[model samples]
Target: MTRLVVIGNGMVGARFVEDVLSADTAGRYDVTVIGSEGCEPYNRVLLSEVVAGKHDFSALTLPTPDSPRLTVLRGTHAVRLDREDRHVETADAARVRYDRLVLATGSDARVPGLTGLRNREGLTSGVHALRTIDDAREIVAATLNARRAVVLGAGVLGMEAACGLARRGVAVTVVHPAAALMERQLDEDASRVVESAMTGLGIDQRVGRGAVEALVAHGRLTGLLLDDGEVVPAELLVLATGTVPSTALAADAGLAVDRGVVVGDDLSSPTDHRVAALGDCAQPPEGGSGLVAQGWEQSRRLAARLCSPALSATFASGSAKAVPDRDPTSNVSDVVRLKAHGLDVVTMGVCGSQRTDDPAQRTLHLSDPDLGRHVEVVVSGGLLVGATCVGAGPVAAELVTTYTRRTPVPSDPAHLLISALTPQPRGATGSVADLPDDATVCRCNGVSKAAIVSCVHDGAATVDQVAAGTRATTGCGGCVDDVCALLAAVSTPAPGEPTDSPTTSRPREDDVTKGKHMIHSAETAGS
Candidate 1:
């Protein structure tokens, strides 16, 4: 059996291992995984939910793969890569040999270098960064007594964290260096609506401000001193500045490293064909979106290539064939949605802020600051190329679907923004059951309605079972309601039959329609 070693057992890394095990039915490889966290892999994307008291720590646990040929080294840190020896050295002086190596060393939460941020003990009390499960736990625990909190960033993660803390009845203030929140995804107009919505949720914002120092009192955080010489009083501080890709291991091994480990579309390092990298630690030609869905796609593609018979034959001869380059445009819809309660913000492709003056690009904008709603769509080549929607759930949902599916835009792009408000035909409710078999229900995993129904037919009755079988509702968790709706439609018994199954009871049509509205409007929009 070929030896395979994978580093960084995070969400993407773990999914890659699962994909390999699923495809390698011949038992052709012995897989070993290294995780620095000491615990089983969990969904790091939902850490904000944990902070909101929406789920317990145990709820974040991910399913572990059980196989005799697989070995997992939890709490172990890989210290060195011996390229010449074809092995990895751990911090505990252990070495693991491998014929193939995968680096999924994701990323680290970047903590800004502000005065009084750190002391002799490192990161004075009450200052925390939300990256790991442990960090979420610490933040949640602190929220019990934290009446006032300050979040130092206005990116997706920062806004989510701020809203989460506010949900816990904490007065949260978000300080951002950027003039607008989520500037990468939202333009100034859409951001204004989002800011208004967040304000309605009782979260304060200070845009275009920088944190000059963290004020500590008696070894604990008391407030943040801004560059404007203003001190915002707070008992706790959460840093959501950004993330720095963990490429030290790859760089130290003499592999190419830019912002991340440089790899080709095939995800193979130029210097070493035997070594591969994916997830946040690797920079591919198409660039990294820093989204878990993108990493999951990379993992799926790499695993497919590695398990191909052609590659297997080449590996046996101590040589490997290059995997065909993936189409750059395939799955290029980088949808970013803020998964915070009471916030409906979603953006995709080229955002409103990034729209250019090209004559061929058709752009439409609608803003209602008083109503806290903004919608913008950019059309090019008769296809929806970019969109930004804030404080408008149904509109956001429709735009996301159009953008991801590359649906042709109406001659007048205004219809794209107002179509959600237009009435549907009689008995033509928006239902998952009405969707075609090929309709994508889970954009994160690309699971189709047919795939989900197949799982239902295979005796997967609950949402969790369907997720385990089809990998739906596992990314961004935006499709759980849709999956549940489908499950009901698939499992409901015919009119005269006895309802014995737990899911045999059918949901009321009105309830289903209401659910559709809530899901499309509130549940991360699409992804």
Candidate 2:
């Protein structure tokens, strides 16, 4: 059997291992997974939720089954990589040989070098970075007696962390350099709605300012000193600035490294075909978003290439003459949903307002500051190109579904912001039942309406069962509501309750290969 060695056993790495093993059912390869963390691979995206008491630490770990032929090494760090010998040396003084190698090293939370934030003993108490389970635990510990907390960076992580702290009755203030929260995902109007929502959540915000120093008193964090000479008193300071791809091991191994480990459309090293890189650690030629969905798609594509030679050949043949060579899976829509509770925000495709004179690339917007709701839609070539919905209730989910499925917008742009609770006028596009079977329900897992229906037909009734069977809503948890709605529609009703049939029974081609990719393409609008 061929020996396959995978390093950095995070979520993407673990998923790739499962996909390869499932495809190679004949035991064609002996797989080994090496994880840097001491325990099994866990979901890093839900760390904020864990800190907020929504889930325990144990809930973050993926419940993967054990394979007799597969070997998993926890707390083992790969120290050296000898490409010529095709082996890796771990810190535990073991040399592991491999016929193929996959790197899922992932990325690290970008921490700035602020004075008083660090000492000879490392980060001082009350100062933390929320990136891992350990980081979440430490923050929780510090919040035990913490009353006032200041979070630096108003990005997704910072805002989420701030909200989590606020939920715990900790007075939280977010300091960011951006004029608006989630500047990359939301436009000005959408951000305003988010700001209002934050206000309702009892969270304070400081925009256009950055924390220059971690204020310390006798080696304990007392507050943060901003660039504008403003001192925000706090017992805790959490830094959620951003992230940088972890490429040290790849670079030390003499592999090509730029913003990340340089790889092709197939996620293979340009110089070494035997080695592959995926997740946040890889920088594809066409570039990549630092989103978990992109990494999940790459994992699926790479798994197909490794488990079946015929599939790889087909992909190679199609891309042989393509300009600016890219992965076929890379051209899917990427939807990002903020996981903060009570914050209804979903942003997909090209967001922000369009400026071009072309009548086709028109942008429709609705901003209700009083209602704390904002919705923006950009249309190009008469199709929905991009959308952003903030504090818009159920309409956010509808907009996400429409954007992901590439569905047509109503002739009236005003209908885009209409509440889902509001009755749809006659001649409307109908409901979720109207969605095509091929319409992706779970973009993170690529589970379509047809796939979910098939699972329902096979005795998988609950959303949890469908998730276990098809792995939908497992990635970002953004599509759980849609999955539940579909389950109710397809499952047999109790007794004489009527079952609503699908509005459209048309069967479009199901590209099950690109699950998350099927939902989100990497195209951002007004970039």
Candidate 3:
């Protein structure tokens, strides 16, 4: 059996192991996973929810595969990579051998070089960054006594952190260098709407200025000094500045490293085919979006390639055969939705002010700052190429469906914005029952409506059962409502029928296969 060693037991790393075990049913490989965290692999995407007290640590845990040939080392750090010797050296001076290696080291929070930010030990007391469960725990504990808090940075994570602190009954102030929040995803108009919505939640914003220094006294954070020499009083400080890809291991091994570990579409290192990288740690040709869905997609494709029959034969015979090529069209999803409470913001494709000037694209927008609603769409070739919606959940949902499915829009383009006000037609966005069989309900896993229906036919009565069957509602937890709705719709029997009756009709094999293929194609079209 081939020995497979994977570094970094993050969400993507653990997912790759699960996919490999599911496909390699014949026990063709002995797998070992190295994780720096002491706990099981958990969903990092929902960390903001954890800060808001919406879920406990257990809820963030991911499922692990049961296999006799698998070994996991928790709280272990990989110190060195010996590409020539085909082994990895852990911090304890132990060596783990491998025939193939996958690097999922993920990323580290980037703390700027502000004065008084760090002490002799590390970050000064009461200053924390929300990148791990420990960080969230610290932030939560601090919130219990913190009367005021300041968040540095106005990106998605920053905004989420601010809202979470406010929800805990703490006065929150956000300081960002950019003039508008989420400038990369939203234009000025949409930003104003989002700002207004946030203000309604009692959160204060100081945009176009950055935090210059940390005001610490007695080894505890007291406030943040802005660039304009203004101090925002606070007892706790949360830094959501950004993240840097954890590429030191790859770079130390003398591999090609750019902004991240440079890899091809296959996610294999150019210098060493035996080594591969994915998640936030690797930079592919299409670039990394720092989204969990993109990492999950990469994990899926890499797992497929490593478990293919062709590669297994090559490994057995010691031949130089190249791995089979993947479908070139498979692209990662670019959808960005904020997971904060009382905030409805979603953006996808080409957005912001820069793209509106494209002569080839048709743009339409409706702004209502008084009501805190803004909707914008960029259409080209009769397709929804870009969209930005704030404070409008229903319209945002419809636009997301259209954008992801590449569904043709009405000729006028105004209908895309106006249709949400009227009753939606059949197979439209309002009701789960009206969605077409092929419409995707879970964007994170790319699971379609028909797939959920098929799972119901196979006796999946609950959301957990359906998740176990189709892997829906597992990522981001944004699709739980849709999955529950579909389950209720399919599990409900005809009038006067028994309540516990099983679904009588099952989807045809051909139909299921075709639906899967179509979903795959839609996912990979713009790669």
* Whole-model lDDT per candidate: 0.81, 0.74, 0.81
Poorest lDDT segment (10 consecutive residues) of candidate 2: 518-527
Q: Over the stretch 1-527, how does candidate 3's per-residue lDDT look in tens digits?
A: 99999999988899889878877867788999999998999978778878977767787898888889889999989999999999999988889999999999999999999998999999999899999999999999999999999999888888888988998999999999887898878877788888889899999989888888999999999999998999999999999999999999999999899989999877899999999998899998889878777787777677767777665454344332221222122123667777676788888888874465778899889999998889999999999999898888888878877887788999999999999646667765467778878667777777778888888989876666788888776777677767766766776677887765667433344533332222111111111
Per-residue lDDT tens digits of candidate 1, residues 379-410? 89999888788777777767766776566788
1 or 2: which has the higher lDDT?
1
Candidate 2 overall lDDT versus native: 0.74
**TM-score to true structure, per model:** 0.91, 0.87, 0.90
Scored by lDDT, model 1 comes in at: 0.81
Best by TM-score: 1
Clashing pairs in 2: 332-520, 332-521, 333-520, 333-521, 334-520, 334-521, 350-525, 446-515
**Model 1: runs farther than 4 Å from truth?**
309-333, 423-426, 494-526
Q: Summarize candidate 2's per-residue lDDT along 435-486 as a digit string, tens digits.
A: 7776666665666678777877777655566778888756665555566566
